[model samples]
Target: MEERVWTGWNPRLTTVFSVAKTSTSLQALEAELNSSIACEIEYASVYFFMPETCKKNIPVLVKTASTPYLVVYKSGIPVLNTPILCDTLTDNGDWIVIQRRTSGDVDFFKEWVH
Candidate 1:
């Protein structure tokens, strides 16, 4: 796997509050993430507030390794369900890793159904 180093948060980008908790298992983390008010970005490993809520695009740090990411929700805040957990950046959470894919492991031409 190719390691992508995180240089730090950009000053111009909108801040993303860390709402993730430390999870003991992948299932637990998935459940937490799905219930939080966040969305996954394509290049970054961290979750950020949804575009509709934030009203702007927020850039996050990238992590290339396979890891579990945590999620937490404030009381009374609406929870949104996001089932898929594919990330392309390094995460800083304490959860079990369920699946990992190295470079060239995915077949782009193959039809995948989950």
Candidate 2:
């Protein structure tokens, strides 16, 4: 699959698309991402030290500016919205931005990626 999709722990929650799969539509991509997020959330509390719902309520401050938080990312998303991902550094307090590298990045889809 040319589409680079990964769901696992690499210091933080990460899911990325290595290459776009023309065969898959955007809807399909979102579904796949949701699956990844869901799987990670199920086990995230143990590593994040917060409950599934509690994670979002707590706004963390990261000096590094790049903290991978899957549970929190998913929480902010609405039940029905095409997820947007952007690979860049953003200065939004309590809100995180992601860079596009593919293999090792935290919350690569925290914002719209282009």
Best by TM-score: 2
Clashing pairs in 2: 4-18, 84-112, 85-111, 85-112, 85-113, 86-111, 86-112, 86-113
TM-score of 2: 0.21
Question: Which parts of model 1 are misplaced by more than 4 Å?
Answer: 1-66, 75-114
lDDT of model 2, residue 57: 32
Q: Return the lDDT, model 2, position 23.
A: 40
- The alpha-carbon root-mean-square deviation between model 1 and the true structure, to one decimal in Å, is 25.9
Each candidate: RMSD to true structure?
25.9, 23.5
| CA-lDDT, candidates in order | 0.35, 0.44
Q: Per-residue alpha-carbon lDDT of model 2 for 79-102, expressed as tens digits? A: 823223322224423333444566
Q: Which residue segments of model 2 deviate by more than 4 Å? A: 1-24, 50-114
> CA lDDT of 33 in candidate 2?
97
Query: Would you list the clashing residue pairs of candidate 1?
Result: 63-89, 63-90
